[model samples]
Target: MRHHFSEQLDLVFDELAELCITVQIAVRQATEALLAGDGAAAERVISGDLDVDERRDRIEVRCFRILSLQQPVAGDLRTVVAALRMGSEVERSGDLAVHVAKVARLRMPRTAVPDELIPVVTRMSEIAVDMMGRTASIVAERDIAGLVELRALDDEMDDLRADLLQKIVGPGWTHGVEPAVDLALLSRYYERIGDHAVSVAKRVDYVITGERP
Candidate 1:
């Protein structure tokens, strides 16, 4: 029975790892679509969101099943609880990526990002993807190895969001208010992606250390 319970716990971990990977791919794909003005790619990202959400739901169900069957105690309980919470965070990240794709689609043939601001949005996407990949590692290792790294990535994301905003509102911004609004919304989407990745790390840390990081 103990071995079977351990196997069940492992399933929860495996599902979470897959969930993280799905989210990371969504971020990368959405960023590509946003930058390239690829409506097809953007559509792919939008369609893929349902798959990620379904996987998240499966993870939640697995967590509850383990708890109901095994009645996990102490650290075991912590791990299961953390998995449930982290799955939701990852699902939100996936939704953010979908939002990015929707923005790209909204712009139609024209790229949503202005030429000058491309570099800023590109950098934000890179950092968001990096942080999300690190989140998977954090869950797999069941350690705080990426805790500090996640925080630093989030800080960079925030700074990038601010810089993007300044460019939009600054006198030099000639892209017009509509385009500026699109960029502003895009920056927020990427920043929120970074935030969700950090939240995943914190949840994993809690499971391992039995204390909030």
Candidate 2:
């Protein structure tokens, strides 16, 4: 019975890992579509998000099964609870990627980001993708120090968000309101993705230390 319970817990972990992979692909495709203004790529990402949602549901169900059947205690109990919360974060991060793709689709045939702000937007995407990759690794390792690092990394994205916002409203702005609104929403999508990654890491920290960071 003990061995079987252990197997069940491991299966739950596997589901969470799969969720991370789907989210990574979603962000990469979405960012690419956003920069290139490729409607097809954006559509692919939007479709991929459905798979991410399905994976999250599987993780939640697996966690619940383990809780009710295996009756995990102590650290194992913490692990199952954290998996539930992390699944939500992973799903939300995937949604943010979908939101980015939607913005790209909305302005199809024309880049949603202005030429002047392309560099900033590109940097934001890069950072967001890197953060998602780190989030996947942290999900497996559950490192407390890594949690601290994740928090600091999000601050950098926040700073970038502020910088991007300034460009849209500042005196030198030449792009009209529509493009400005698109850019603002684009920056926010990237920032929100970063925030979700950090939230997952915090969830992991709580499972490991029994204290949320």
Candidate 3:
């Protein structure tokens, strides 16, 4: 029975790793669609969010089953609880990616990001994607050390968002208010995605150390 329960826990971890990968891909593709003004790609991302939701649901169910039946204690209990919380974080990241795609779709044929601001937005997306990648590795490897680097990347994301916001509201701004609003929202979406990745990393730390970061 102990061996069976251990196998079950391993399966849960494997599923969580795959879910993180899915979310990472979503973030990358959503950014590509936004920059290229590809309505088809944007639509694909919007539609794919349902898969993320379903995956999170399955993870939650498995964790709850382990909690109720196996009644995991100590480190095992922490792992199960952390998995539950991490699933929600990853799901929210996926939704943020979908939000980015929706903005891209809304401005189809013409890129939502202005030409001058494209570099900043692109960098922000790069950082967001990188954070998600790191998050997936942390989940799979249970490397608590990676949390430091992940948090640093998130700080960079925050700084980029602040810079973008300044550009939108600065004296030299030429883009109309509507575009400004969209850009602001897009920056927020990417930043929030990074934030979710950080949350997942902290949860992984909790799983390994039994203490929340």
Candidate 4:
């Protein structure tokens, strides 16, 4: 019975890892589409989000099955709970990517986004993706220090968010309201993605330390 239970747990973790991969790909594609103003790429990201959504549901159901049948205890219990929380974060990450793609679609033809902010946005996406990858590794390793380091990404994202906002609100923002608003909202969504990545790290920290960070 214990062996069977362990096998099921491994399957659950595998599914969760796949969900993270889907999210990471979606986010990268969305950022690339935004930077290039590629409407077709944006549409692809939007459509691909449904796959992530379905995978999230599968993860959640598998987690519940483990709890209901396996009745995991102690450390195993932590893993099950972490799986549930991580599933939600993965779903939210996909949603953020979709949101970015939607903004890309909306701002087509005119490309309201300021050229100066492209690098900043790109850097923010890179950081968020890295942090998420780190969080997933931390969960697998149960390393407290590694999990704590992921929190620092949040501060970097905050700084980038502020810088982007300042640029949009500064003199160069005289371009027009539509572009400014799109840029502002897109920056915000990217920042939120960073937050969600941090949230995942914190959830992993909780599973390891049994205390929320």
Q: Write the per-residue lDDT of candidate 4 for residues 1-213, one digit (tens) a residue.
A: 789887887787677767777788888888878888888889999999889889989988988998999898987888788889889888898999999988888878645467876788889889877876776666555565775566677888899889878877888666677877887888888788878777776776777678755
Model 2 residue 128 distance off true place after TM-score fit, in angstroms: 1.0
* Candidate 2, residue 185: lDDT: 84
Using alpha carbons, what is the TM-score of model 1?
A: 0.96
lDDT (C-alpha) at residue 160 in model 3: 88
**lDDT (CA) per prediction:** 0.88, 0.84, 0.89, 0.80
Q: Residue-wise lDDT of candidate 2 within 1-213, one digit each (tens)?
A: 889987886677667767877888898899889889888899999888878888899888888888998888988888899899889988998999999999999888888887778888888888888888788888765565666667777888999999878878999888889988988888888899998888887787778778755
Question: Least accurate stretch of 10 residues (summed lDDT) in model 4?
Answer: 135-144
Summarize candidate 3's per-residue lDDT along 1-213 as a digit string, tens digits: 789788888888788889989988898899989999988888888999999999999999999988999998888888888889889989999999999999998888888988888898989999998998888888887786888898898999999889888888999899899889998999999999999888888888777767767
Candidate 3 to native Cα RMSD, angstroms: 1.1
TM-score of every candidate relative to the true structure: 0.96, 0.94, 0.96, 0.90
Clash number by candidate, in order: 0, 0, 0, 0
RMSD of each: 1.1, 1.5, 1.1, 1.9
Tell me which residue pairs clash in candidate 2: none
Reference-based lDDT, residue 63, model 2: 85
